[model samples]
Target: MIRIRKAETADAESLALIGEQTFRETFGAFNTKKDMDEYCTKNFGTRIQQNEIADKNKCTLFCESDNRIAGYVQINLNAAFGAVADTSQAEIQRFYIVKNLHGKGAAQALMNAALDTVRRLNIKHVWLGVWEKNLRAIAFYKKFGFEQIGEHVFLLGSDPQRDIILHKTF
Candidate 1:
């Protein structure tokens, strides 16, 4: 069974590990080792996670299986990054599940938690960016009722890549 819960500051280290592990597992083969190493080191550091946990505008949730973190999702409550029409918008910053748990309903549980959090916050809209080349991830978002709205450039280390922006209105 997957248990979804709000992440506390104590989870920073675990988040860092899972964040890097999942990220590398997903994108490592597509990119160079230098790029992956740089991105992971800069973004998944424990200190950064600690600061993120302290941010009031961000909500991070973890999905646990057998008492270990199986996945996680992070949302930016003050999202205005892309073509948002109003203040009733939030961004699904990062939604990642371990490779081993990809098809085991962990993602669904984590997504449900994110949507519940958004609805409880009275945010009527949600959006996220997915790499254009990542068809699996795009399909997953589409299955969750998100639609393509726009495109933007995302920097993965030294690489400038295009990310298709998807939006959903609750």
Candidate 2:
């Protein structure tokens, strides 16, 4: 059985593990080992995950199957990419699923929970930044009615990559 729930601080360690694993799996192929290691160590550590989980302006949701985390999504109500004109917007800061769960409904379930969180907050718009080269993620966002609004630079370690800013207005 699959279940979705709000992530708690206690789950930080597990979240960190999953976050690092999925991030490496998704981008390691296109990036250098040094860059991947730097980014993962700096951003996906347990302390970082705990801080994010404890942040009041952020909402983290986890999708679990058979008591193991399959994926997670993080939304930030207080931050937005400069491209978003609307101040009343929530940003989907991170959305990742295990590679094995790609064809399953874990991503969809996680996304649904994220949108529900946005609706509950009365946010007028929801936006996200996706790497320009990540075709699969771009397509998935488009399926959710997210349209490209602009572009921004995303720094992964020292590498500056372009990301398409996408938005979906309620």
Candidate 3:
């Protein structure tokens, strides 16, 4: 069974580990080790995770299966994106699940939780960035009615990759 719950500050390290692992599992092959390491160093760290957990505008949720964390989602209430106006919107800054749990309930649970969170907070729109090459993720978001509104460059090490900015308006 997959259980979803708000992440606690104590889960910083575990969250960081999962972030790094899932990111590597999903995109490691296409990326150079140096690039991956640089990206991970800047984005997936215990201190950074902890700060996010403590941020008032951020909501972090964990998906647990068999007493172990299977995935997580981080929602930003104060979403800042050039594609959309900064009003009445939230952003799914990060959403990741272990490769083994892809077809399982982890991703669904986490995505549902994220949407529910924003809805509860009275947000009218939600957005997220997905790599252009991540076809699976793009399709998944499309299933949730997210439409591509813009694009941005995401720096992965020295490579500047394009990310599609998808949005869903309630």
lDDT (Cα atoms) of all candidates against the true structure: 0.93, 0.92, 0.92
Most lDDT-accurate candidate = 1
lDDT of 1 by residue, 31-138 (tens): 999999999999999999999988999999999999999889999998875587777999999999999998889998899999999999999999999999999999
Candidate 3 regions exceeding 4 Å error are none
Evaluate residue 154 in candidate 1 and report its C-alpha lDDT on the 0 to 100 scale: 89
Candidate 3 weakest lDDT stretch, 10 residues? 78-87
Q: Give me the displacement of residue 73 in model 2, in angstroms.
A: 0.4
Candidate 2 clash pair list: none
lDDT (10s digit) by residue, model 3, range 4-61:
9999999999999999999999999999999999999999999999999999999999
Q: Give the winner by TM-score: 1 or 2.
A: 1
User: Cα lDDT for residue 137, model 2?
Assistant: 99
CA deviation > 4 Å runs, candidate 1: none
In order of appearance, the predictions have TM-scores of 0.98, 0.97, 0.96
TM-score of 3: 0.96
Q: What local lDDT does model 3 show for residue 42?
A: 96
Among all windows of 10 consecutive residues in model 1, the one with the lowest summed lDDT is: 78-87
What's the count of clashing pairs in each model shown?
0, 0, 0
Q: Positional deviation of 135 in candidate 1, in angstroms?
A: 0.8
